[model samples]
Target: MRSLERHRDVAAYALGVLNEADAFRFEDHLMECPLCAARVTEFGPVSRQLMLYRRATPRAVHPLTGPGPRLLDRLLAEVALRRRAGRRRARYAVAASVVLAVAGPALAVLAGGGAGQPVRVEATDARSGVWARVTAEDRVWGGEVELRVKDAAGPRPCRLVAVGRDGTEETVTNWATPGRDARPHTLRGGTALHPDDVLRYEVRATNGETLVTLPGA
Candidate 1:
């Protein structure tokens, strides 16, 4: 298998998505590849983050009272069992220093909003009719694209369009409405596009001749 495919499989293994045979194959690869092993180690932190969130948001126990200590205790027990099973897996140790070296700069950039930039698009998913978020410097509207206004002075009507790299475009605006905050709006009866393949999104406002385009296209 190619290195990228192996890495993807490693991620899937870390995410607990691999079957037994694939898991064995990956384990054998991990023994000889220090870099792949290190990448696999990143999953430890990801798993911990998942666990923390799960603990913070326990399942509701009572209709009115919500989750209680009993639920937390059961969750803890499950986590402990999983940890014990993980201990039996092949130990491809990744140095703590290496993890810190790579994580420091990544964390800094993500904290600075350098990673949260939205992609602008000219169309919506032909199947799903949902547009990806677009970044704008000021209020503007054009074509099938609509701006996600934080708080407009009055009610704003918007339409979403999904466009693919294959030159396929789908536009939906039948149920669009304005809101006080920016929330994901969906266009019904449209197929969802793969994140990697989405070319752009188109946004347009009601009664306006202009259209807004976000970067994805």
Candidate 2:
């Protein structure tokens, strides 16, 4: 039924791959269904591990053929469903082997501890009236940053900046601020600077005004 379809959305939700409307619906469903919510929690660590590889790729290249991220996402969910239904371990192993074969370098990076312990920091800008909580994780090539921002409601464009200890700056990510909905927005980006090398993170408006600044710890 419809509920069963929603249950299968856990993997995509954990991967942050669901479209906004679908994600909102799933989240609302989570409030009522502990089973789906628990599955999402179980998928969290794997989701983070995979996202490091995903974010490192260039945004310009959209592959038209071959198995892509969405395919991998669905595959993972299917594997989970099979396991939950008490399917044989051999089947799960085959599915997982395919994922590992496809994931290749990403699994190597993860196994080598390339994604370090995440550090989280929070800040509120008195002047701009913006509040933010940021989580920074060190990756082999750079750092992965996720921001939860609030109170900067608008149709305005905004960017996240990663400031390095050596005085260099990199634009981690950018998006338009959501209009009056006012719910806290979560955004993730990757930067070339190592997590330890980053001094701070800044949320900036299109006109170059700082909305909030999170000190990197």
Candidate 3:
């Protein structure tokens, strides 16, 4: 069993993939096994040279093995199609994740606010931008403030910052990028505010200098 394990380690060691513990174990076995020692010695020089020449090199051209024009054209077309499909899939995935991330908050805000409420602003797409509605609520003094905003267009960069009249501020929690669909955003936080102090919320898109500021609190 020990010999078998050591033999298995030989290939991994030769490829320089074994960790220190496995290398130590292999060395211990090599001290007592002459056949394994000889095998390691024979491969060691070749392995060292291979490691030394680790840089990748371009494939060398061979006259006899050169691909025919038709084969080359077909392969190129296949490669292009695969690359395009990969990009499309990546975009779809990003759109899906963004929608899922913001769907909950958007629904919550829509439910609490009236269906026809103008407080919620929806983005046309994720690549577009969104901002929450900033309004004065009775619970502001007790730190329960309700803010309605728009969802992000897509997986674009965005941030929400809220500032109170007294200079106290807090950020929205669990906020993420929006999906491809246009949706309203709602954020609620428990931060004490002065009775006369106005709260302000702003959404800034990071990709561009587009800024959306909500009405005063």
Candidate 4:
């Protein structure tokens, strides 16, 4: 995202309206931009304020007497609207993910070469009890790697890595999974590894700890 676009998203980001991918991108930006971080911090108190407003009982006062309660109600309405917008965005995001899941493979194969068939690779992490299945088609430039991960070690953030035959590591993407009671999460990324020149692909935490590996990667 461009600098100005990033700046403009602070409010939707604060309201939690961004999609998972966009939200993660904003957070990665927050780590480096103190200004944006500060804005998020300031916006943090909004929920508390809304809660306080909801708790306040309206005193029986005439319309001519005071507008304070009415103003507070307007503020409450705006907050509710923001929340609704966030929910709508989330629903749209889920729909888009489904569309991609169904359409992405055909598109990838078509992009690679209409005749190339897609391949599936299933992997497991015995130590952490995590598992993944990759559906991808190799291309000369770089190929699309789409897969879902299950049973993560914890809810912390992680990155998917592609390791080539010569041991070159490329970060395909980064994502987060629930710490517990987690459902399978889908992840999609493009790897620079040509199908013929790869060893294995891995999922790693931000700290560089390997989480899971795909065999014949």
Candidate 5:
């Protein structure tokens, strides 16, 4: 059944393999299922590591000559090893989520007590059908940011920028967008400007077109 299949989508969602539609459906399912939410949260670290690795690697194809391809092959082998390890960890995490559920709220409260709530801003570009949500957590050095964006049409490179009140702009992070299948991206970046000093955040394309703008706290 479709509902049962949604239950099975936890791993695919964690691995970032689910298509946009399925991913959205699974996210909706998450609100109704705390166990799945806990599992997904536990799977977060490995998923982030995979995404970081992908960002570091080049997207271009190289000539089939000498050590270049060989080095790439070895890098891919290492990624495979890490992916297997991630899957094993995911399994263990699922088991752990079960234990936490049985243990009740005390443990969950203790685990989550470290950080205060982040300030969040959300906006949509109606013309482009792009949506973005930005959250900022203050730190001594500056501000840590996380962006969740969807419906950004692109086969081009994109970047997130934080605009300061004094008109200075800082490039938070950059990412390559998929051509037709534009799945949601969860990207983390930091800015030297404090959260209060940031005027706004913008998601811009390679051509410098603004897709979404979120005001700062």
Candidate 6:
């Protein structure tokens, strides 16, 4: 029951191929249309799965590069339709989430630490491919967190979220790797909190999956 233009836009938007202007417009529309929003959500992960399948097929080079015309669209649309009849539903490429609308820069220098030394900590995720390091200067009231992710993000978008002691999550940055290769990319976010004000750091998939969390002190 959707128009062809609507379908095309939905497909393009999901694949991250729509031009900036078009994408911005569609995103505005997404805030209003639950159906379109739902469809876009499924395409990212489905595309990643398809990309993996193509790579394993042994004859695919850059197969499924764009979700606009790939098999991902058909599969997700079918699923979305069934769900509507039943149930369902950025990266260095940044989120338009209200929580991050006023976030700080990607990196900030640490200072304070009582004697000009910043506090530092490290933690790794269960997958073992991702880890986070934190450094905060007491008097500066902010810190820098770095994430080194390996072979864990390429098929879908991943986010580094900085959680404050008060439970507010500010997005540090978002990234999606190219193809099935997760060659260890690093993400840095400068948070606006005192060294001790940070409660934890989280690495999550755009789908609301918490990939990992590093406790802060």
- Each model's TM-score? 0.28, 0.48, 0.33, 0.47, 0.47, 0.43
- Clash pairs for candidate 4: none
Off by over 4 Å in 6: 1-115, 127-129, 135-141
Q: Write the per-residue lDDT of candidate 6 for residues 54-89, one digit (tens) a residue.
A: 434546556545545667777777656644532221
Q: Rate the local accuracy (lDDT) of all candidates.
A: 0.45, 0.69, 0.48, 0.63, 0.70, 0.57
Give the worst 10-residue stretch by lDDT in candidate 2: 108-117
lDDT value, residue 123 of candidate 6: 67
Between candidates 3 and 4, the one scoring higher on lDDT is 4
lDDT of 2 at 70: 93
The lDDT of model 5 is: 0.70
Candidate 5 residue runs with Cα over 4 Å from true position = 1-116
Clashes in model 5: which pairs?
A: none
Ranking of models by lDDT: 5, 2, 4, 6, 3, 1
- When 5 and 6 are scored with lDDT, the better candidate is 5
Best by TM-score: 2
What order do you get sorting by TM-score, best first? 2, 5, 4, 6, 3, 1
- Please say which candidate is ahead in TM-score: 1 or 5: 5
Query: For candidate 3, lDDT tens digit of each residue in 1-217?
Result: 3678788676676455788787666656654555664454345445534432332222474433655669778867876775676578667766866887777755422222221121232222244345455543433122234555565355333444556676765433223344453566554443334223445555654333445665332
Expressed as tens digits, the lDDT of each residue in 123-190 for candidate 4 is 78788777887777754345567768886456555567778889887656555454563578776666
- Give per-candidate clash totals: 33, 0, 7, 0, 0, 2
Predicted candidate 3, C-alpha RMSD: 26.7
Write candidate 1's Cα lDDT for 6-92 as tens digits: 767866865557887776676656655656655554554464344334444548643245565698788778767655544543132
Question: In candidate 5, what are the lDDT values of residues 37-105, reduced to their tens digit?
Answer: 556645655665555445445677343324655877887887677567657866776788899899987
lDDT of 6: 0.57
- State which candidate, 2 or 6, has the greater TM-score: 2
| Preferred candidate (TM-score higher): 2 or 3 | 2
State residue 23's C-alpha deviation in candidate 4, in Å: 14
